[model samples]
Every structure is written in C-alpha cells, then in structure tokens.
Target: MTDPDRERPAEADDEQPVDAEAFYEALDARGRPVVTAAEVAAALDRPAGVVDDALSGLESDGDVGRLDVRAAKTAWYAPGRADADERITVFEKRRDVIVDQPAQYTRALLTQFAHLENTNREGGYVYTVREEDVWNAPYATFPELVSTVRSALGGRYEAIEEWIEGQWERAHKFRLATHEDGYVVLEAKSADLLGNVAEPRLDDGVLRARMGDETAWVAEDRTAELKRTLYEAGYPVQDDRELETGDDLPFDLDLDLRPYQADWIARFADSGSGVLVGPPGSGKTVAALGVMADVEGETLVLVPSRELAGQWHEEILERTTLSPEQVGEYHGGAKEIRPVTIATYRIAGMDRHRSLFDSRKWGLIVFDEVHHIPSPVHRRSASLQTKHRLGLTATPVRETEDQEEIYTLVGPPIGTDWEALFEAGYVAEPEVEIRCLPWASPAHREEYAASDGHGRRQAAATNPAKIREISAILHENRGSKAIVFVEYIDQGDAIAEALSVPFISGETPHARRSRLFDRFRRGAVDTIVVSRVGDEGIDLPDAEVAIAASGLGGSRRQGAQRAGRTMRPVGKARMYVLATRGTEEEDFARNRTKHLAARGVRVRETEPVAVVDPEDASATPDGGGVGFEAER
Candidate 1:
C-alpha cells in the first residue's frame, strides 16, 4: 500500500523544468561566483523566466539551496548536500520502508534518545562521524547539491514517486552509503512522519503508535489539556513501584546506597517525575540510577560534561548487568546506539546537525545538572514527550531569562530543599566561619575599586598577606589535605604559585586532572588551589576544610556546594570564607548566606581579629580569620 505521505503529487503543467547539467556546470565554474538570474539565463542560453523558474523548482526540491540576496529579486542557489549524502537518502528510504515492514525503527530511535537524555543534563552524545564520509563535509555545498538534483530532474517530473524512481536513483544510492553513526537525526518532519506510518491508537484518550513488533506511547494530543489537568490536579502522586536494593539484581555492582538515596528512589517512584536538586556529595547520581531501576522503562542518562559522562559510564557499569554493548555513550565525538545509553547535553540538544531524534523511545530521561535546562538547547529537551523526566543538579537555580521555559518544558522542581536534605542526613552539614580581611593599602584599594566585579573579588581574595594567614591557620587548624578555592583562574594560579601547590581548571586535560584529583584524594597532595573545578561532580571526601576566597552574591547553591566538599559526613567539617571588610566583597558574602542557610549551614563571624605576630602586628589592622599573610 502506498502511504499518502510517500505519495508524490501530480506534476503541474506550469511547473518549472530541470536544467541539471546547466546548474551543475554553473556551480562548478566559479570560485564563489554569485549567480544572478541574468547570469544564469546568459549561462544557460535560456530566457530569464526559464532560468528563474528552473532555479526556484530546484530550490523547492531540496536540490539547490537558496540564499536571499540583499535588495535583489534573484535568490542564490547552492548545492543541497543532504540530497547527495547517501546516509540521508538511505535513511529516507528506510524510514518509509521500515514503516511498511519493521515499524520499530521509529520507536527505537525515540525510545533510545529519550532514555539517554534522562541520564545526565549537561553532557552531549557524540556520534562518531568518520573523516572519510562525504556527509561530514562543509555545509556550504549542501545548497549546491540540492540545486543540482532539482535541475537534473527537470520540470517534466511532477510526482514524488516518479522523481524517486527515475531521476532520484543517484540520490537514493547516496542515502544508502551514509549511516546514522548511531545518532538519530530528528527533523521537524519526523513526528508527522512517524504519526503517518504507524496507525496511532487512542488509549484512554492518550496517543499510541503501533509499528511492527513494537508499540510506543506519545503524549496525548490534548493541546492545552495536560497543562489544565496538571493545574487542576495539583501534582497528584501516581502509583509507581519502588525497587528494593539488593533484592533483585541482574548484575553485581559495587557501591553502598545511603538511606536517603533509597528515599529518593521512593519519591521518584511515588511521584513519577520531579527534579532532584542536591548539593555536591549528596549522591544524586546513584539515587537517579535507583529511580531508573524502579521505573519500568530502560534508563537514559544525560550529563553536562564529558568527564561526568565517563563517571556515569563507570558507575553504570558497576550497577547494571548490561554489557558494554547494551550501554551506549552518544556524545559529539562518538555515535553508536545502545539500549541503555549515557550522553551529553550537546548531543541531545543544540547539536541538531547530528540529528539525535533518530534514537528509540525514551522511558525516562535524567538530566544531570538540571540548571542547564535553562540553556536554549537544553530547555527544548523538557518539551519532549517522555514517560518520566528527572533533572539532577547540585545548584538548580540560576537567574537566566529562560526559567519559565525550564519550568514548563522540563518538569517543575519537586521541591527538594537543600537544608531539608542536610537535616535528613541525605547530605552532610558543615560549620561555616566568616573571616574578615582588612582593608588593603590605599593604593591597593584604589586599584581594586577600579577593576570589574570579578577583578575586585580577586584582589580581595588573593591578597598576598591573606595567603600567609590562611597557611598558618591550615597548619594549625584545618585538614592536612585542604582545598583553597578561588573565584578566578588567575587567582588560583597566584595562590598555587605562592603556596607551591598544584591546581586544575576547565582547561586541564582529563588524564592530568584525574591524576591531580587522585593525588588530592589519596592525600599525596596536601593542598590544592582549584578554581571552579571543585564546584561539582568530583568527589573529595577526605578534605575537611574548604577555603572560599571569592564567589557569587546570593548564590546559595554555590555556597552549599563549596561547603559540601567538606561536609561528607566522614568527620566534622569547617568551611572558612574570607571576605574583605568594607567592600562589595562583604555584601556578596552576606547575600549568599541565605541560600546556604537552607542547607543548615550557618556562618558565624569569629570575634576580635588576631594580627600577624611581628613589629607590624602592633600597627596592623586586626582582621580576624580574613587577614592571612601574603601569597608568600
């Protein structure tokens, strides 16, 4: 049976003709020649109307690509590369063919992509495109390719079937050669294509598609109904099964589950969908897996970073009985499909060129670092029709303009309070001590005030004199293994240079960073001056002290995460924040206090500052814990 979607319309008598050879020759002649209608007519030795009509027809057929020319009636045509790419052609053929035979292809793509997204929020799946493939070539030639195809078919071919069977044979061959690299290309037309191929079944007013051996569920076509129901229902808890730990297992995974993690699973099981906002070391990852285990669908995890993807891969390996084959990692650099997949945000979101929509139907999508969903690409993931969506983040709130989009698109926050988590012992609580640094010399103060917010914070945080005081305090009081965190990379470099300690940043390579983290973990490195790398994901449990030199104003999540580095319940933890007195630094420090308070972390100001011992001590300002010796 010829599906209506696969049917080509009858050729129009007034439709344009294809000048395939002429178009190809014209594209090949110039080193970036701007072809105007007059130029095309001259080249083809045809009338201007013929040239214009032919070019328009080619553009419509996706053979020739058209770009607008400013203040001109003529549109420029480039080759449409997708038309020539065998991978796309084959996909087009197979997509339609499979609908008639094995309808599961559509379902498989949707399911898998959806599941992978659920895994982590910030990471992207890489579909490895071999350098040898023609499809991976530059985007400039795509319009030209399309134009060539259209011109070759000419105006005589009016029906889609006739074009596909006759003149499009070459195009079909290109599609056959180009493979998906395990990453599915989700186009705007894909949803409609799927709807047409698989007869949609109406179940309890919900939309269901049955394709070959598989049946998949889609969000009901309620238009405004779902939102209305949600508003009226007020987040009713659905009956879902919670998985018991160590009760049923397909594989032997090594890891201890905290009771709070069990409760996280239970909550997800109870409510079905919500965001898991926790501070660092709160074990959000493990809890997410448990939720996946409890849910009926295969788990799809998405993360923000490649390192996090690797981390999840290692953890998933430990937990699932699925072999390496079953667990696929779809990132930007590599593209292979798997039943249970782990991917990055770049793969699922903005990296649309790779066409991620080709994956299977996702039962659940886990967004690690939920705050990222506010990003333009990530926000779109929330609107995707998935069975369950879980967003995981250490700090979920960022004052981005797209917060409303996040709420509507990615499910609303489940209301997991950071303080509540600490009180419940899901996360550890730390004692926060505020240290006031003395005003810098007049010259230094002028320089600081002259700089931007970031610079001012740095000048205050890394004053050479303050480092020595911190050194003394660390030697006398904090852990042997301590992390001195600064807001700026330069400040980190300065402190590390001064203290003769190692440090890492976003620019740090994976191996070197891993080695540094290991050394810190093993206590081989006593003090590490890390910038923002310490904020999320990396586990530094043994460290008992966190010295925050500078940070955001009223960023409760940042404060909680920084403090949580030492609050791992291994022992009593102390978080010392050095704030320069009588500046925005003081105000920024105070503003963040409220959010941290939610985590049950209170910052107590120590009284009566002690000056560095020396002849200068008598004259020096008594800056409490804040006054540290210079970077010496």
Candidate 2:
C-alpha cells in the first residue's frame, strides 16, 4: 500500500542553483563596500528573490556577514572583513538576538583599531560599527580609534556633542511626581541605550530613584525638604496631592488627659499625621486613643508584638465607647476585620491583610512603637490609605539611618521633654551609677580571650563579678520594686533563680506571664528578671530600680528603652550598670550610656569592686567578701 504522507524524492525545482564564487565577486565589485540585496541583484543581473536566497546561503556558510541598518536596509560585506573581533559596532535601534556576541571583544578591537562610523544623512542616523559586526578589518591603536571617531563626527553633526552632553545631564536629573493613590513617585531620566534607568540616585545621595519600565518610580512619602532638594538640583517636581484631613468628630471619654497628652492630640488633629515621642507611662497611648475617638471612623492600630496588640485591644474596649463586636484582632489564626482592628505589624503586613485594609479608606492608623515602621517589612503597612496617622513611641531615634525614612513616612516629630518632666516632678528622676568590676576568674579570662567575638561578649556580660555586683545592688534595694534586664534567656533564668523572683521571656505563656506581671504590680514580687522582650511598650510604673546585668553592645536605643522602663512619676529611681573595667565591655558601656548622658542625666562613677579568684578558691586580702567604696 502506497502512503500519501511518505517522503518524496527531491525534484530539480526543490534546490535552487546559486554560484557562490560569482555572488562573492559580484558583492566585492560593488561601488559601495557594503550594499543591500537589491543592489547586489542589480550588479549580478539576477532576480531579487534568488539573490536574497543566495545571500542567506552565503551567510549560513560563513562566506558573508549581514548588518541590520536603520529600517529595512540589510547590508552585506565579506565575512573576513566584517567579523566581530575586528571592529566595534553601535546600533541606533534596540533589537534582540538569540545568541549575543561578547562585548569585550568589541571593546578590545576598538582599543586596537580605528572605529568605523556610519552616517545616514537622509535618515538622520549615526552609529559606529559594532564589534560583533567586525569580521576582518585592520586593527589600529586606541589613540587611532579615538582619532577615527573624532574625524568621523567632527563637522557632520555638531548636535551629536550637544546630545552627548544632554545625555549626561539627563542621567543625573530626577523629578518628583505624585501617584494617583497619593504616594510620592520619583522618576529618573537617563540616556541609557534603551532609555531605561534602573535604581538611579539623586544629587543628595540619600534619595534613590526606583526603576520602572520607562522611568524610575520612587514610592516613598516625600517631605518638603525632599521637594526643595529636587528643585535645588534642577529637577522639576509635581506634587498636587492634597494633605489628609480628618473631621473633628464628637466623642467622649471619662479619662483625663495630661497637659502634654492634650497638646499632642491637638497637634495631631491639625496635621492629620505625626509622631509623638514621650517617655514610657507618660500617657502616649492615651493621646493616641484620644485621636482615634476624635477621628470617628474605621481605625487600624499596628503594634510590634502580639502582646502589644492584645494590650491595645484591651485598652480600646475599656476606654472607648466602641463595643466589643466592633473590634477585631487581625493576627495569627484570628483573621477578623472590623471597624476597629488591632493587628501586629507582622500580620498586618501580610498580603491578605494589607489588601483588606487598602481596599477601603481607614479613618485613622495608629502605629505603636512607630520606629519599627522604617524597616522594609513593616514599612509596607504604611501604604494603607488612612485619613489620620498617629505614631507613638518612647524612642524616636533608630539605630540606623532609616530614622529619616520614618520621619517622612509617619510625620515630623512632636516630642515631650523628658528632662522638663523630670524637673517638674512629673516623671521619676533617675540616679545613674556605673559600677566597674574586676575580670572573672583566670580560667574565664582565658576562655574569653580564646573565643570568638560573640562568645567574648557573652563572657563579659555573664561575668561572675558583675553577677555579684547585681546581687549587691538588689540587696541594697531590697524593699523597692526592681527589674533586672538580661540579654539572654539563660542569664535571665540564672538571675531569676539567684534572686528568687519571677522571670519573663518571649517563651512564657500568655496566662502565666500575665499572672506574673499582676503579681509584680500588686507588690507580691519585689523583683522581676526579664529578657529584652520587656524593653519596649511594657508599662512597669511601680519599678523603682533597674539593674542592667547584660545588654546588646553599644545600642543607645536599647539603653534608652531600658532606662525608660522605670521612668514613672515617683521618688528618685536608681539605675545600676555593671561593666568589667579595662575591657571592650567598658567601651560598650560608654557607648550605651551616651544617649542618656546627652539627655542631661548625670552618671556617677562608683569605686571599683574586686572579687576572689574562683579558679584557686582563694580569698581576697580582706577576707572572702567583695568591697566597694562610696559613690565618688
């Protein structure tokens, strides 16, 4: 049986006959060194279609090379004369090729040979021959290449020089625009080959131009200073978006706001967004709540931790007229959205939650511990549309430069004077003491020297001498409520065991932690040992003393937060920091206390204390007890 789909034998018409040498000679004899297929057909006395087919065959066989000029013009030259390694070519149009030739080859060739410059006067086009298009051309020195380019572009187009200068200027310019959604957009223009600039920088070196398909888009909230910076840099800016405004809605709360708290709410009402920096237990939360009540619409509160979220939920229900049914918790498994939603920063930044909040306009957004919002992960939540924003934090200064970003994102800072509060007897005045202690035992010193950076810090923080000093400080303040801060969980546990007090860490269950906190609040517990989890937004107004036994190295923010834990209105509070003298720990201690010192808190140095050598189990010259001099 014969199959119609079976392959058939080749016929005479299937393969067109083309004389390879004749085509080559014909191309070589052309008046113009490079000619199109039509010109080659005319010179060869052959049909244009036949000539085009022949040229394709020649290209595939490596006998000729093809150059795509402007529009539909395809120029052909001898393969050896137009090979990639021998010349540099620049394209006037953007195109994609399957296999890209190496750019270094062109650069090297340009360095050795004079570049070939082609100009299409009629088409208003000018470009140099690309390295990939160079097959076989004479190579010259780099100076010769420069001279060739200069000679080619000398007088034909004086506008080319102006265009080059214009490109340089464009690459450095940035413009500010407002997106339809009200976020600031920074667009960067550059003379990139494809006219696409990615991640460009402005003149100030701080603002970055984000890249888009055609232009760079900056999606940060812009301040007046940023606008002025762009204008000074000679870039046009467009900012037509209206500032957010909130209605002075009617509401009532039985709680009396402090004078400072009332001033913060009033300022926030005028601006519609701002950061309120106040000491812990200084009624910052109360001020934020007052704003929420006055805004009188859907409210979204973002907190740093789940515990804080729970705290906010409790406070809202107790202090406001809003009913429990109107409030919701958008955290973990409970993904409820209501008129008043309290969510942790982590959960609220999730796509599902962000979309839900962004789908509608919120009346007010309260960012607790707003300093955390400058981080990239938390900053995404700032994109939510809201009429009013209130940022509440004990520490407005961040460890990183992103502090500036926070100022722009939330608003300018309106801070309460901690020193003024202390002087006026509105907040507790702290007596700071820096107690220098001797190094640990000989064995411990050797271990510290032999360990890595992290291990050495741990050894310094957990020194036996420091621990003894902490014990002494605790004994001295036996009747006062105290909080001992430790960097590590094991340290907190050890200190808690030694002091016979309750300990709290991130691992503590909610109910147990709450009970422990309640016990401390009721004066049932004289001292509580806590890890870094208690550093921020935890109200411990009754704590009259703080002993910082361990901490992160040289973190001013951490130091400030720990000091703020005891800054309630009361008699003078005592803060004791135990550091090993003549070690890196001493340097870190100085750095840690710098923030406090800047705020006019006097640091008094106490005489050094010496301890017995634990390795030899030997007693000191004055017996087995540690000795300390009175404050100097």
Identify the leading candidate in terms of lDDT: 2
Model 2 per-residue lDDT tens digits across residues 1-632: 89743655434223545566766666566533345576677776666787888888888988776764211135566754433322222332321111122222122222221222221212111224332212111111233323333322221233433343343343235545557776565555444511332223233433445446444444354334454444334332333334354333345665888776787787676656678876676778888888887777678899877667777788877887777888888887477787888888888788866778777567888999898887878988876777667788766566684464554566556655465456446678677777777665666666677888889898878776665677677667778889988888877777777667788998898779878877887888888988888887566777889888888484677877888777888676888877766568776776676555544455566754434454555533212344443321
Any runs in candidate 2 off by more than 4 Å, and if so which?
Answer: 1-250, 608-616, 619-632
Weakest 10 consecutive residues, lDDT, candidate 2? 132-141
Q: What is the C-alpha lDDT of each candidate?
A: 0.52, 0.61
lDDT (Cα, 0-100) at 294 in candidate 1: 69
- What's the CA error at residue 505 for candidate 1, in Å? 1.4
Q: Each model's TM-score?
A: 0.56, 0.61
Candidate 2: lDDT of 161? 33
Determine the backbone clash count of candidate 2.
Answer: 18
The parts of candidate 1 lying over 4 Å away from their true place are: 1-256, 352-354, 401-407, 412-426, 449-458, 607-632
For this target, which candidate reaches the highest TM-score against the unseen true structure?
2
lDDT of predicted model 2: 0.61
